[model samples]
Target: MLSTAARQAHILAKSRVPAANFGLAARRFASSQVQNEASKEDKATAVPSPEDLAKASHLPHISNVEMPNKDINLKNKLEKPDYEKEGYQVPEWKKAFGETFVSLFHIDMDNVRAGTIGGSKYYYMCKDQGLQFTDEELSETAVFWYDTLGLPRTFAMWFQITTLHVWLLFVRMRAMPFKMGKNYQQKLVDKLFKDIEMRLSEEMNVLSGQIRDSYMKDFHSQMLGMIFSLDEAFAQKSDDVLAAAVWRNVFNGDKNIDIVKLEAVVRYIRMQLYVLDSISDRAFGFGDFEFVGPNETVDLLTAEDKAQLLKMTKMKFEPEDGKTLPSQKSKLSLDE
Candidate 1:
């Protein structure tokens, strides 16, 4: 039996499909060859060890964060913020000028990720963690889901893991002020499906548009169901409830799942929400939110630190002379 590290390396190598770059004619030819290679590799690989079955974030690669004591209930650790009550106001000047600038340049601050190369900033935030990985690279968050949690590296598994992160972000976005939050959610969802479609065609080699459309429909339904369950758990504001939701969806109801691993996931979700809650509307609107690493900790921001951050933001966006070009004109505040 291979060690956890060796197993991951072997699995990644065997399953690693070369990114599709060939024309339609070439891709049709390469698909069978790729499948044959995968089959050969499958026959050559060894089964995972019993230790692997028992493990979840038990290894050093999983995270530096220590697991909770068996007696400790994670329910007390979860924090749910009331975004409606705590929501910040968007200034009229900012809206009027921001809209004018957007009309001229076709940039919507509310959905700035749409302006990004591959979709919204939020898309990358959700993706980089787990959904997207290559033969040569596995993201830190990917390690957490795949290595730490001992999940299979199939496309369906990827979707399950990615959906969990996306749902967590949705929690934050839904808590945001209505109009802006809705726009952000729509843009992120649009980009997510767009990428999924592309991957189905290019990465998964589903050349049939009809088949891909069916998969999309199925995925859309799953996404909605996952969101509904997660939202209900979140509303309940109990870590145990949230963990059960994670177990049902992300872990796929694995009866053998380690309780410590479940607790880690719950802890991770709460930490992310806490960070999102800490961010201001202006900062997040401008694409400032990032997932903290599973092994890392975020210190509470002090009043002086926030003041300095705002000062720096203003220096970067606003000019000293106050004479801005029409294309560059923006009334979005550096401080919100």
Candidate 2:
């Protein structure tokens, strides 16, 4: 068998073909309350119980799905937000104060937790099946990883899958303007380590913080290497190079790797990148993008469709007579 480096080199050499051949089309919260003005009012209402208080507030949905084959409603449940954007009803004075503060401080509050929220919610979608499903009821991408590729269902394998998807996002982020791109990358990486640490403790049963930290360091190193390798392949604009990178990093360089499955994965990656390239930087930064289902095909948007999207986005963010809060104001364009 060829050495690992030699194998990678061979794959890259074979990938001298332009990337175009790979079919890279272009394209919350809340509530509470309390009672009373005086003893008469308090006696009349009796300080609403905790249950009553909870019933009064419309809390956001939080997923409780954990085990395999048990998350029958995972897709449907994920469509709801963890925190609602409306219903906060800040006072006009406070809104004005916030607007002043934001202007004075020059804070871009619009994207404040974009990375934290977006990464935690969406990036996990890349390999969520391992956590949500077992071998019995796998998702489309899960089937590709576990059934088609015959990879073991272990945390290591899951990391490989998640990392591959993360790298695909990185490609799109790299195309973004530098400051925004850097912030998104940093926040996403921060969230990744945070989640990994939790998984290592809970799932892997590391028990000891020192040991978990050591494992984290190792994974961090591995991620850096994968990013570098994938970045190089993307720069080369060669599907072959991309395939080689996926083979080495995602498929673990399995000598028995199924070439057909590998090609499908390459196609999947290309398809995702095309969708990412087609989105506006504002839409992505604000956490508006979702990964296309593994089996879904994305038809290129026509000029009319693009125009309609811009119109809808503007209506959502900048309604003509709507009372958009200053905190919600964003300089990002809807048309872009």
What are the per-residue Cα lDDT tens digits for candidate 1 across 83-160?
Answer: 212255667888678668777777644445324411455676676576533443567667667776776666777777
In the predicted model 2, the residue pairs found to clash are 28-83, 28-84
Model 2 residue 235 CA deviation in Å: 1.0
- Writing each residue's lDDT as its tens digit, candidate 2 over 248-293 gives 9877787876666666566566656655665566566666665654
Candidate 1 residue 255 Cα shift, in angstroms, is 1.1
User: In model 1, where is the ten-residue run with the lowest total lDDT?
Assistant: 1-10
Residue 77 accuracy (lDDT) in model 2: 42
Question: After superposition, which runs of candidate 1 have C-alpha atoms over 4 Å from their true positions?
Answer: 1-118, 132-135, 302-336
Worst 10 residues of 2 by lDDT: 24-33
